[model samples]
Target: MSKTCLIVDDSSVIRKVSRHILESLGFEVTDAENGQEGLEKCDENMTDLILLDWNMPVMNGIEFIKALRARSDGSSPKVVFCTTENDVEHIREAMSAGADEYVMKPFDHETLQIKLKLIGFD
Candidate 1:
């Protein structure tokens, strides 16, 4: 079966762009407007991978990762922090929160694909 991916970001444009890229790479893509919605969707149907954004109106990516890792279902999906936060501290924070990889914003298909491959997605 094809792998599933969840794109969590407040920006509609980012979600749309990520959905297109992930779909092109053969992923069954789903989207959420914020971390809360992302968590809700994950509870309903766990994804193989999650592309998360840092800043949002509701819960942030780090918060979501922490909550997801705390789940008892063993649903540890590969999480990639896709955000504009490129500082070292933020990256370390994300890793500490259970993110498998990181990707900066305004990424092209190649960069995203590289991250996916690094996380064993393709």
Candidate 2:
């Protein structure tokens, strides 16, 4: 089966950009505008990976990761925080919260593809 991915970001442009990129890499994509919607979607579908954005209107990426890690399943989506948060502290916190990977924003298509491949998702 084709791997599925969830793109969670508040910006429509970001979501669309990520969806197009993942689709080109043969991933089936689902999307949500914020962490609340993302969590709901996760419950509805077990995604192979999640491309999450920090600083959203509803719940943020960090909050999402915390809740996801609290689940009884003991495993959540292989999440990659795809955001503009370049601060070391934020990155460290995301890592501590159980994100599988973190990618800073302003990423090119090649960089995104490389990260996905490194995670064995591409």
Candidate 3:
């Protein structure tokens, strides 16, 4: 079966763009508007990978990741933070919070592919 991916971002544009890129890469993509919705999706069916955003209405990426990692099946999905937070502190924070990889905002298809490759997903 094809691999599954969940994208959690507040921006519709980002979600649309990411969905297209991930679909092109052969990942069955599902998207949520925020962390809470993402968690709901996860509870229904654990995805193989998650592309997360740092900021959102309900919950943020860090909060979602921590909650996800707390679950028994949480460690199964590779979490990648896709956000505008490019500073060293944010990057370190994300890694510490259980993100497998990081991608800056406004990423292109090639950049996403590279990030996924780094996580052995591409």
Candidate 4:
């Protein structure tokens, strides 16, 4: 069966691009505009992967991941922070918050494929 992926980013362009890439890789994709809405989507269905963004309104990626990790099945979904935050500290923070991987913004199909493979999703 195809795996499920959730793209949680505030930008509609990012969500649309991510959805296309993930679907091309054989994943069933969904999206939300912010962290709170992303959590709502998770509550409705079991998501296998989450492409999360760092900065957003109404709950950032770090806060969202922390809250998610507090849930019963929070660890079930592998989270990958897809954002413009490329500093070492940011990467470390994401890892500390239960992110399985980190991908910089404006990722292409091949790049995303490699990252997903590293996380055992590709």
Candidate 5:
């Protein structure tokens, strides 16, 4: 079966671009406009991987990760923080929040592919 991926971001353009890239990579892609919606989606149908953005209106990526990790289902999906927050401290904080990897915003196909490969998705 094709792996499922959820792309969570406040930006519609980012979600669309990520959906296109993930679809090209053979992922069954879904999207959410913010972390709260993303969490709801995840609860409804667990995804194999999550490409999460750091900032949003209702809830943020770090908050989402914390809640996700606390689920009783023990569904440990690979989470890659896809955001513009490139500071070292923020990267460390994301890692500490259970992100499996990090990708800066404006990432290309190659950069995303590398991150997917690192997470054993490619």
Candidate 6:
């Protein structure tokens, strides 16, 4: 079976781009526009991985990560912060929040593929 991935982002463009990339790489992808909706989706489906955006409305990535981390063992998805926030502090904060990986925005297909592979998603 193809691995399932949930993409949480407010931008339609980012969702479209990520969907295309993940599909091309053989993943089954689902999407949510914000953190709350992402949480709802999580409750409804089992996601193998999550690609989360940091600056979304109605619950930013940090809050979302915290909430996910607060869940019981079988409830949380493996998450990677895929965001525009590139500062060292931001990366550290995401790591501290339990993100398995972090990838900066404006990434090309190759970079994304490599990062995913490095994280054992490929």
Q: Model 4, residue 88: what's the lDDT?
A: 98
lDDT per residue (tens digit) for residues 1-122 in model 1: 99999999999999999999999999999999999999999989999999999998889888889999999852579999998888999999999889999999999999999998997977
Q: Candidate 3, clashing residue pairs?
A: none
lDDT by residue (tens digit), candidate 4, 10-65: 99999999999999999999999999999999999969999999999999999999
lDDT (Cα atoms) of all candidates against the true structure: 0.92, 0.87, 0.95, 0.95, 0.92, 0.88
How would you encode candidate 6's per-residue C-alpha lDDT over 15-65 as one tens digit per residue?
999999988888899999999999888889868889999999999999988
lDDT score of residue 24 within candidate 5 = 93
The list of candidate 2 runs beyond 4 A from truth reads: none
Q: After superposition, how far is residue 49 of candidate 6 from its true place, in Å?
A: 0.8
Candidates in order, TM-scores: namely 0.97, 0.94, 0.98, 0.98, 0.97, 0.94
Residue 18 error, candidate 3, Å: 0.2
Kindly report which residue stretches of model 3 are placed more than 4 angstroms away from their true locations once superposed.
none
Question: Whole-model lDDT, candidate 4?
Answer: 0.95
For candidate 2, lDDT tens digit of each residue in 4-122?
A: 99999999999988898889889899999999999898888869889989899979999998988888752746889987879999989998988888888877788888888787775
Off by over 4 Å in 5: none
RMSD of each: 0.9, 1.2, 0.6, 0.6, 0.9, 1.3
lDDT of 3 by residue, 1-122 (tens): 99999999999999999999999999999999999999999999999999999999989999999999999999999999998988999999999999999999899999999999998975
**Which lDDT value does model 3 have at 80?**
91
- Angstrom error of the Cα, residue 95, model 5: value is 0.4
